[model samples]
Target: MKAAAIFGPGDVRVMDIEKPEPGPGELLVEVKACGLCSSELGMWVDPNFKTDDPIFFGHEVSGNVVAAGAGVSKFAVGDRVTIFTDRGGYAEFVTVPEDWAIKLADHVPYDWALGEPIGCAMNGTSRSGIEVGDTVVLIGIGFMGGLIQQGARLKGASRIIAVDTRPESFELAQKLGADHVIDAREGNAIQRILELTGGEGADVVIEATGKQGALDMATEAVRIRGRLVIFGYHQGGKRTIDVQAWNWKGLDVINAHERDPQAYLKGIRTGMKLLEAGQLDIAPLLSHYFELKDINHAFLLAKSKPDGFLKAVITF
Candidate 1:
């Protein structure tokens, strides 16, 4: 088997590695597709964040089960599945616990089945307690941001405003069901959001950029008593926040990550059902595809963010 290992910053290599066998209550899956995530970029550039261990990267993955270990009864050999490996998904084969292996229905395409980010967005959005008829604003139109926009729409947001610096991303957000799109590079993004929400701040503001500026803006863009959900991965760091403003507005801050098993399961079931029913369309979000051999190119493209590049998948 071949796998890509990240030893440290600016260090990644493809090498022959032994295929892992399923352990108790685990399933051995032959990976079919995996999407590159933006968080990997941080891991590549930061030395302190670097890992000495040869970590097999990738979490959003879809594949087929080749074998199951003892105590695995929900699935059998040859069952198509998607997994949130958390790590070790960038390999030809990944051994994952049965609990994380989600069996895909026959109708879902393997390409779209690898949409674990959707589950992440779902978990975060649910945590925000976005109610129908609320005005929602999402800052950032990356993969998670796009999914957040769609999820907000599905949750019955009366007005969905998507904020991003890229024009292409703003347009993509509109296509993804955002009622309004704002280019944050322009001046007065917060003012524009307020105007869109008719003078009142948004009922819910989701910060998906993980940038310090975006975090500050999220806090400023929400209405009094509104909720602010930080959905993106912010590599452990400290950021200054206006505690007085947060206290004055009585705002609720929620930090979301894909850690809860029950939430992951519920999100997968809901997202899969939406995809199967054609209520949610992610085809436009997939910008490029690459073979596993061209994994390096895939990483480069993800880093470049070239025109029309939203999500890139390495397929087997």
Candidate 2:
């Protein structure tokens, strides 16, 4: 089997590795598409984050089951599914625990069936406590933020304000049901959000950029007693928060990232259900594709994030 491993910063090479077999209660999947996640960018771009040993890093995987191990009765050899794996997904073959696999509808596209991040979006929006007629403000309209916007709309938010620095993100944000899109580069994002909400600020504010600037704006964008959802994967350093404001506002702050495997499994199942029911559309979000051999190029493009780059998928 062929797989990708990072030798160092900006160096990901495809090399031959022995194909993995399904262990007890596992399923061996022939990889079809694996997503390039933003969380892995640290290892790909920064030398300080590199490790002594590098294993396969891609984890958002969707493919066909080629072999089923003992005690794996939930899936068969030919079932099309998306799986959750600790690692080793950037390969021709990878094994998945039976409980971590979710069946995908035949209509779902392989490239768009990225279960992990979609599951993260589901968990994030669910944790936001969005209700009907609530005003929701989303900071950072990237891939995770965009998915959260759609989920917020589906959850019956009356008004959705999308904020981002990139001009290219505005169109797609509106297309995904944002009532208003604010360019953070203008230095008036908080003011615009306040004006739109009649000075009360939003009922729910989600910070998905993982940058300190976005986090500061999110703290100010929510209503006095509103919910503040942190959905971003903040990496590389420490973050400071306004403890005094949080104390005064009585905000219900939620760190929306899930750690438990069962929680992720539940979210993944819900996301897949939404996709199958046509309530969620991920096709527009999967904007780039590359083969396994070009994984380095894919990582560079993902890091630089050129125009129209929502997400990158490595296809077999």
What RMSD value applies to candidate 1? Answer: 2.0
The reply for model 1, stretches above 4 Å from the true place, is 48-53
Evaluated at residue 287, the lDDT of candidate 1 is 87
TM-score of 2: 0.98
lDDT of 2: 0.90
* RMSD (CA, Å), each prediction: 2.0, 1.1
Q: Candidate 1 on 1-316: residue-level lDDT in tens?
A: 9888878766777779899989999999999988887778777666676676787888888999999999998989999988877657778999999888788888888888865777777777778789999999999987778777888888888988888898778878978878888888887899998887777799999999888999899988999999988886876588888889999999998887766677887787777778878876778888899876777777777777888889988788
The top-ranked prediction according to TM-score is 2
Q: In model 1, how large is the Cα lDDT of residue 291?
A: 77
CA lDDT of every candidate: 0.83, 0.90
List runs of model 2 lying over 4 Å from the truth: 50-52
Each model's total of backbone clashes: 0, 0
The local lDDT score (0 to 100) that residue 139 gets in candidate 1 is: 92
